[model samples]
Target: MMYKFLFWLWLFIWCVQPKQSIAQTLESTSQEFLIRTISQVDFKQLIEKIKTTHPLIAPSIEMVRCIAPTLSVWCVRYTNRATLPQFLTALHAFPAVTDIQTNHLLTKPRGRLISDPLYTQQWQLVNDNINQNTLDIDIDAEEAWQINTGGYTTHQDTIVVAVIDEGVLDSHPDLTHNIWRNTHEIPDNGIDDDQNGWIDDVLGWNFKTNTNNVNNDGIGHWHGTPVAGIIGAEGNNGIGISGVNWRIKLMSLVKGQDEASIIAAYDYILTMRKKYNESGGKQGAFVVVAHASWGVDSLKAADAPLWCAIYDELGKVGVLSVAATTNNNTNVDTEGDMPTTCTSNYLVTVTNTNNFDEKITGAGYGKQSIDLAAPGFNSFTTLNTGTYGVFGGTSAAAPYVSGAIALLYAMPANRLMDSVKAAPAQTALRLKQCILAGVDPVAGLQAFTVSGGRLNLYGSIQQLSAYYGLHQSASILGSLNAYPNPIKEHLFLKVSLTGATRLTIQITNLSGKTIKSRQLGTLPQGIHRIRLEMAHLPNGIYLCVVQGSAGRQVIKLIKK
Candidate 1:
């Protein structure tokens, strides 16, 4: 009876052990490979040919999907570790394959983490002389917030900003209200509901793990949640701290530290923006700006031209990208730095500044490369633990710029919204101009940065308001109108005022050369029209700038 029992036990053990070992073996051997094919190659046919021709790797390898379908880039998963070289060789033999590269791991750049004794207040936004902070040395966020708190455009279109970093803790109390949700997508249904190629991407995409779980709780990934909080943490709810914008939508794009992963992440952003533009705000997300807080130092544009070129593509589609300079306190222009060095007007590069309104010792600076500085040292922000903490670095600085852009979009300006609808590309560049031109000149940054100043949120908002003929209050320059835009002989001007005020009209050429100027003395609270002779002016584009006692406006005119 004992011998019979022993035999039965041996048989039971033998039956289940191989199944467990096989599962472990498959998990251990799985590897990801990114492949770029020529434009004309048929993806499905090529994938099948590779599988059938290389029989040894047939059962172990599978095509994941085309990440950048427009670019013919595909990611493949191979579980036959022992036959990886054979599979690669077979792929190389195909004439359609352009390039093959394995995924490269990357680590986030570390900023100087100095603990401040007083972390209770966000002096970076107001700077009320706390902790020896210089009075009024902050971003003037209070004044800007009073003008617009940010959530949707004046046209009532929801504003969304993409945070391309590790990932965001979307469920955190302070962020839950502002987190972006794909209403078309059904959660955890094991199906591609929207058919955007990603499965169950209700929140956002995770390029690192190729999954929809963008809420990363990994050790170093703590960077993303804080960054997101700095851009759009919910405000006035009496909970935690408020971000630059209290009510803007934030999208998470989780990425690994690799060129391919970064490109894939951006491609996802490009895809969404393109869809929005094509669908007339019906199907896709309206991501106006994207923020990246991580970059590699000493990397040049020559080495990553594709990455550099992506900025231009984004700009063409009316999306601006903001990036952080390396925190090495080095001259990025000479030593070289990615992204910041990319000469795309659509790209805004930011360096770190302290509460004293001075550049930090460990932050990067370049007179021509770095655009501006922001309060990045010891600023209070949300943490991944569903709590508040002091988050700083150039990482913190970049979001201030992004939030400013989103805030500008939220302004209730009819002309501003009209311009965006008419010429999105030009409007994007104009926003960049507002940011660079409205900076508060800082003596410490004068010789080290392009703007030679720190960010002034109020000033930037004012610049946008002036450019688009918008005022904080309706009492001054209520409306401005210029007709017969392509004037052949006469250009008519109409001004609407809420109260009596003097008005000045200045017409300048595209090169900013003043072509004409007129002073229309004080007028009562009503609409008035005036005509100007334009028969002698050469054929070209011009700016009709109108200024009043309390506000200003600009109109575009074309002379025929």
Candidate 2:
């Protein structure tokens, strides 16, 4: 009788409990919601609500099962080698194929490959042993000098730097002011007001969901915010870490963990460029410096076509793409990642260096592909929590270079376009020069970097200021000109050798290593023409230094 009573009591308690769907329970609580199973009605209703409330959300509802279990399959597309009909036939033939679509592609498998044990050990040491104080080499005073003495003044004209990563924390105090504004679209209007391929790209577009909700979900990996901080954190706000160019705008393009998503983001950047050019709205020199931190270890030639196409597209419209060198410590020349190996003249491939300013052990090395190196180990930068934290990777280092480029471009007003256009080569030359001009000889100039040195922001800015200022006055001393700025096969240099007995033609990038050196047999009096055959040269910027018996003249050249 007691057992029967207990059973009846248990049944009563179970029946009286709340009868709510998992969605309702998850929606009403603060815990993370993982949608496992949904009734057809609930799923349809949820999608409809998303469409009505968040019109920019373009959900690719179809699911595609992957061979790997841990990988989150998003979307799949047909490769160039396979026709649509063939792909469809294959999909129909295979029972394992759950779903397929054309809007996006699945992310590469997150495979663990053999890494250098020594480098991995070193990384562990850096990760576990280093602190903020140890990593923060006092650059505040030097940074101040660059801003003040180097003629680095904050201009009201804003430059937009697109952070193509996971997403951004829109509410982050340090980043809010710098976020890009979509003036054409009204918020929550459920319309593509801008009509620029995105509905409401107010804080920037999210290609992951093909939506406007480009907010940091706090769990999707905090890649974008740190990158954003490196580029344009609010300066002099008495807040967290300062960005290289705080006055510029920050555009957030949410790229998911897939190549197709990245490609879509790239397309969005191009779209913005077109809009900025055709609109005639602001008329200021708008520069979009995209910071891409994602890469893989495999060397696939087929991947080259997409990257090559994107690279050419970026080059045509004067967009600078800065990519992170893979952290695999492998030789990039023999086996490199896409986009970095795209061989585009406009793309600036950067590797990682440590606090000691030494090349990070795991950082990818390439005598030909990598352009420069920047501090990446134990890097102290802003996080999505609106605070500062320590993170390290070639990923972190790429943005330092990207931010420097933005700052360099921000210096000149009327010549902003030309300045940004000339930045890659100048940056490359500066890196090369810094390495060559290093204090230690045994460290060996070439051993430091491909360009052969660390990133010197102050020196590069000083050089740019001196170079462009002279051009403004119509003076020949500062006007070192190169023809076919984007040189395909040959680069011609026109200069006036005024009272110079011997001239040494030195080509270097930002790191200060001499890329191309030629001792001009002799300078014949006045206006002279020197030709450089760049048939085998990689696409990038090279600083041509005409060091005469009298003095030195530096000119920026681009190799396509």
Candidate 3:
């Protein structure tokens, strides 16, 4: 009788265990949706309208809300399981419905060791600019280094980055020193010394099991370590490679995380940041940003409420969260991607580009959705222990921006928040704007990313310099910015100057024929707007040139 019972139990265990690994356990009764019902419709009217539009969500259970922003709101509900997918895709067309998300388990990209050399292979850092003739296909990290080498400054020693991914090789030679340690907790004491709800969390907590056991991140998982190396692999160490921020701290947040787990991770980081700042850097991690390299391909409105709600708290703490878009070559604007697609002002969505400064075949894009692109193709960084690798994906592209953000905050030349005497909220906004304002206007990306440009660290530094009056040269190069792009009737152009000087502005078509030229003699040291009439011009792309005492700058213009 005992033998027969054991055989039956073994069969049951095998069947159920495989099912858990094969598919995610979804919330059968719950669904989440985002809507613009504030002015359009009330809560009761919205729910009744959804039921009227699709009766399949019948026998509805309780409705709850995780986040209810002033303009857009997130709503949750319990509905029929069999009709959820149909109801969601159907709601895509509804004018009142902005998003229909589901409870999806996110996945991470696998990585491998590709090389065994020193820093010469780190092309993404300093592309000798001779990528078979293209001059500037790299991020120009050296220029940023000239501004600040991640060295110690008055503000802080190093900013913290909470890396959200699978797992990392904590013992890697290049990454060991930069890891974030939870000094408040007692290691291996079998007790929660800090009373933060996590025991023995000497290192960053493992959200998967809600335990301190982070070393058991599995053998095959190789994503987190490399991404961490890309962000803050100690520079000038004369050992392996250098990351975007030469001297920065990394907080490892291992994934296999669900919506609730992700929220918990952010919550933990926020708590640590608060403790650090409130205690005058005496305790807690001063995490400035969170790096999320793994995500679901598509997040229905049902799956996004908690994350959206948590992001608000993140922004309030002066932290920015950057997410990588889908890796497929398809457009995210027409299709869709998650976290990257989540509408949060605190989030920066990144795409992948290659060595030739062009979008890779498998990299995703979106004119309205994707914010920017970076070098994710065959980009070199630390792999597992004692190994260097070349990896390519949106996952790889994201850390570059993360590390770049660290560099931006480290510079004493940062005047983004210096001039206007900004409030805390405004300081965070200025940092975000500094990133968006200084991109290098890629030709092909014109219709894709919102910036229509690639990340340029040098340009960002120059922007800060000009803003702070740090540039002591009157021979300043001006920036030409045109608005209402694809203009049909009229276009407005702002010519910005660093110091007072005379300026010559002109417009031309592809044939190099001068469309118009305007001369504003000896304009004051500031911005001047020039309007170009385009109603009579043909519907084609044009160029605008700004020539002044500082230098000459040209910008591309589109007329619809």
Give Cα-based local distance difference scores for all models: 0.78, 0.56, 0.68
**Distance from true location, Cα of 537 in model 1, Å:** 60
Best by TM-score: 1
Backbone atom clashes (below 3 Å) for every candidate: 0, 21, 9
lDDT of 1 by residue, 1-560 (tens): 99999977775554444434333444432255677899867766876887788777787764356778788898776655567656666666666776666633222111111122222377776564546777567776766665677898877888999999888877788898898988878999989887677889899999999999898563557898888887888866667777778889899999886889898888888888877778877877888897899899989878899999899988888899999999998999888898899999899999999887889998888998999998889868888887788888898888888888888888876588777767778999999988988898989999789999998886787677667855446546754555554566878775655457898999996456788999988986544667888899865557888888877878777654
Q: How should the candidates be ordered by lDDT, best one leading?
A: 1, 3, 2
Candidate 2 error regions (>4 Å): 1-156, 281-285, 413-448, 470-560
- Give a tens-digit lDDT track for model 3, residues 364-427: 7888778888887777787764477777798899898888877777776545434222343455
lDDT (tens digit, per residue) of candidate 2 on 363-475: 88776777777776776666877666777899888887777666665554344345434453344344233322321111422553456655655445444544443222222
**Model 3, residue 318: C-alpha shift (Å):** 0.4
Those runs of model 1 whose alpha carbons end farther than 4 Å from true positions after fitting are 1-120, 218-220, 471-560
In terms of lDDT, the poorest run of 10 residues in model 1 is 107-116
